[model samples]
Target: MKCVGLCPAFVVELWGVLEGLCCVRRLGFTKVELNTDSEAVGQLVKEGRVTSLLGNTLAKQRKLLEFDWIIDISHTYCEVNKCVDGLANFL
Candidate 1:
């Protein structure tokens, strides 16, 4: 389910990934490619490190991955990230 909402950047970004995970789980997909413009978030996922602020949510995302799905996530410059391009106009 694609979504957009009024919220801070961090909240929306985090929610996006978490929701994406939920969708993948529901669809019984074993692989996912996630992209984000935030390097900090990319690193967190790649290293399996959850921040205190998002610890619980991150844990849920982790638990959903026990299915051995290939999840590849990377960081790209916001200017080059097309998913967020239209959203930028609202800024």
Candidate 2:
């Protein structure tokens, strides 16, 4: 989430979610409890609709979900996401 200039925040946020899921999948973890600060990401993922600036990317995120596993996408306020948010900075 650092220095990702000019791109709409929703696009970047959705990209991060997709990439994070990819990593989790590679680790052989099928069930994932993912949390995001963006409500757009959650809504779009749960109910497919490419209405954002990065619709293609969002669509790709949906494509990545065609797996035989349970994935629960949740939303958290930035205030409660403090720990993970700080950790992302280190990465």
Q: Which candidate tops lDDT?
A: 2
Reference-based lDDT, each prediction: 0.75, 0.80
Q: Estimate, for each residue in 19-86, the C-alpha lDDT of model 1 and write its tens digit.
A: 88888878988878888888777776667677787798678777765667888888878788665766
lDDT of 2 at 21: 80
Q: Estimate each model's TM-score.
A: 0.73, 0.81
Name every residue pair that clashes in candidate 1. none
| Quality of model 2 by C-alpha lDDT | 0.80
Q: Which stretches of candidate 1 lie over 4 Å from their true place?
A: 1-8, 87-91
Cα lDDT tens digits for candidate 2, 1-91: 3355778777678778878888888898978998989887888888867775667777777777778878998899878888987876677
lDDT of 2 at 9: 70
Q: Give the TM-score comparing model 2 with the true structure, all chains together.
A: 0.81
